[model samples]
Target: MTGIFQANRALLFFLTLAVLIALSSVVVVDENEQVVIERLGQPVRVINRFNPTGASGAGVVLKLPFIEQAVHLGRGLKGYSAGAQKVRSADGQDLLVDTDVTYRIIDPVRLVARLGSTAKLDAELASALPAMLGARLGPLSAAAIALPGNGGAAQLLRGDLDARARDLGVQVIDLRIGRVMPGETALQMTYEIMQARHLREVDAISAEQIASARQTRAQVAAQAAAILQDSAGKDPEFYDFFRAMRSYTYVFENPDAKNPPTIVIPPNSSYLRHFNGQ
Candidate 1:
């Protein structure tokens, strides 16, 4: 029994030693990340330097567990929202705009030196992008900022970003006006005013057309009446005959049958007197 107890104690001691050895080192690099192995907080090895496609040099990357450290650098595109901001237009219109910035760790060394970590980069975006967009876009009128025309607003903003983004170590490939609308409580009022203006224009055009048509109709009718009057005055006999024909048509086609229709005679009674041969 004494020999068995001694053997068990020895086995327990070796198992504890093995567990300690395993805990002394760790590797958390994924296939999409580049691992920087550091000793005493200083970079010693950079694995997967060129490409992030495969798990190259991705084994039990040994390190003194508590003394050594490893940082996995992200190797692809990442994005963050800059949140909504009230940007003013050249015409003093308040526009709430949001921006999304897409950037990548191009130079890991520079990124580590400048930003220290990916979390730091994200934290910096909130403050950085708003200042950039606001400084670039503010003091423009709503029409200019929102680009009331075809695509002028976006072109203007792109030019601004292109000129300035290089200093930030990130390329601003594109920025867009996501949503632009009136940001006041009187939005409905503004809409109604715009509608009223359009409706007034339409009504003015309609009224002008109506007046023009009326003038044309009146002139044509008056001209036709004058022509008929002149022709009738020149030819009295035919005029009298046509007058009698018109009177006959009016009397015969009158719809009311309540009383017998009578053709009132003039003082000379020229139509019937001429027909009677005196």
Candidate 2:
């Protein structure tokens, strides 16, 4: 009877231990989500990653208990709202815009290496989307964008944004844009317009500085010409030697040395009189 009781206790202990191990090691990857298994902070493998070829890595996956971590990423398309953004048009018009981006993690390993998690990805797009809008829509006609149906703004943004999204390990599937006015976006646009005016003032100042620089260069060149004339008046032979030295300097110190002059001078040419001690 004592031996039987001991055997039953040992069996129960083994069963409980197995259940605990199973619980720790089991990972469930949903149809809409992908799981990245990491061992000691390094990604080991991705499960249920996006596969258009129909080899979706969904279903139950196992990882080393206590040694590996599982990170969840959406296998399907995920939508990101960039909120209201203010843009400066080519005609110096400030526009308030709202946009939504549809994206999916194309490379899980790269996404993990760069952004770590989807939350980080969201934070990145939140910051980057506005800047992208400024660059893309700024050069386009503001009047057109303000017209009906937002002037196909989504198509324009999606095309370029998708190309840029490749670096972020994401594929931009779609983009939706609308002209937003009279709210937080309007206030932001007001601030941007004021900043633009300030930038124009600064540009005016820069133009004045550039004109002053050109005048200074012209004055210096005139002074140099006077010096050369004075040297010519001193001695005719000395002037010739001096001129030849300057010519030599110009020839040897050519700015376009990569394509240096190819003309060949004869040994007894008049150009070599100074070198010949004449």
Candidate 3:
């Protein structure tokens, strides 16, 4: 019985020791982050916590148990550090612009020291970005803000953001202008201008069509009048002969009829002289 009790005690002690070792030796690294293990406040191991099984550049690493703790860092494109801002143009036009920024962890040490975490950096960017954009855009006109520079608003905005975010530890790779809208007065003015231009274009087209139609009608009437005048001028005798033939057609249709067309005959009528043989 004494030997059995000693054996049971040893087994219990070994099991306890195994449990402690298992608990203390485990470490977890997420897929989209990195870990910096510190030993007594000093960096002892840097574990890239981004994609443990993605590639083989830095394999899954281990550290001494209970001697160090890991600090996580971002591995891929994190969110912007800034929020949206409202700015006014040189023309006193108010514009609300939402910008999205793209960045990565370039200097982890500086990033950690400055922002403490990816979330903090994102917040800082969100706040700082609007101010920077507003400051730069303040002196610009409405046309300038809406159209940007010769390269376009996007290029101008990108250059401006790149210049501003240089010292913020995270590089501003790209910025997007999410939404653009005009204020009440400006929109009204724009509508009025468009309407005026449309009315002018319509009037011009209508006037052109009216003038063209009038000119075509005048030319047709003038051509008809000219043809009649030319025929009278070229053959006066034929004109008279045609008139006589028309009158004869009406009068001769009813011979010896009273109230017939009275065509006055001259004293030297050729038909009467031939019949008398004089």
Candidate 4:
């Protein structure tokens, strides 16, 4: 009975020891997170890291027990709010812009190497927004920067964010501009300046149109005078008859003829010769 009892005790102890070792060497990684194995404070490898064109690494991973530590970082989408930052426009107008960015870890290896964790990355991201916004929006116009729906500045801000986030081992999926506000006094001044510029443009266009109209009228008058002169040179008598006919038609048909004089001439007068056929 004592031998049987000793053998069973030995077997149970061995089984328990094996289970502890197994549990220590194995780590379960989830689909929404990546694990980085660090050996003595140096990153040795990563598991379940983001891959755009390959299978996911989320599952059970074997690690050397007691010698390695796994640092978990979020592989899911994360949002960072840059809040309202102050920047100057191209015209030296100060503006406040609030923006938000969404990103995901694409290269966990690089992320582990640079910041090591998401919390640190978040802090770093918070500090980087001002410079990024200032660089892109500082050269834009006041109206574009101050206005909420400015697409140009939004596009520029996107490009700047993409460039800035490249070294952070993440991909910026979306960017949003929440608000773009300018000071009340500055906004009024900017509007006045813009209005003045537009009015000047309208005045210049109107002046050009008037000058073109006057030039066209002068051309038409010159053309008509040349036609009349040619007609008189070709047939002087016919031209005289035509002029007399035009004068009689105007005196009778022109309701608004200016200060028409009374006529008291004979029926066979020179002015009536064309009509009287004498």
- The candidate scoring highest on TM-score is 2
Query: What local lDDT does model 3 show for residue 201?
Result: 100
lDDT of 1 by residue, 129-201 (tens): 5666666676566666666431455555655654454443444555666666666643777888999999999
Q: What C-alpha lDDT do the candidate models reach, one value each?
A: 0.66, 0.81, 0.66, 0.81
The parts of candidate 4 lying over 4 Å away from their true place are 1-21, 146-151, 183-278
Q: Identify the superior model by lDDT, candidate 3 or candidate 4.
A: 4
* Residue range 94-146, candidate 3, lDDT tens digits: 77666667766655555555655566666666656666666677787766666
Where in model 1 is the C-alpha error above 4 Å? 1-7, 26-28, 50-60, 113-116, 148-177, 184-278
lDDT of 2 by residue, 1-278 (tens): 88898879989899999998889899988988888898998998889888998687688888888899899888888988866587777776666788888898899888887888887887877766776787667776777667655566667778778877787789999888755554455578889999999999999999999999999999999998898788788777788888889888877787666888655889899999988877
Clashing pairs in 2: 48-57
Estimate the TM-score for candidate 1. Answer: 0.53
Estimate candidate 3's RMSD in Å.
12.5
TM-scores for all predictions? 0.53, 0.57, 0.52, 0.56
Judge candidate 1 against the unseen true structure and give its global Cα lDDT, from 0 to 1. Answer: 0.66
Specify the poorest-scoring 10-residue window by lDDT in model 4. 145-154
Worst 10 residues of 3 by lDDT: 49-58
Model 2 ranges off by over 4 Å: 1-17, 148-153, 182-278
Report how far residue 148 has shifted in candidate 3, in Å: 6.9
Worst 10 residues of 1 by lDDT: 162-171
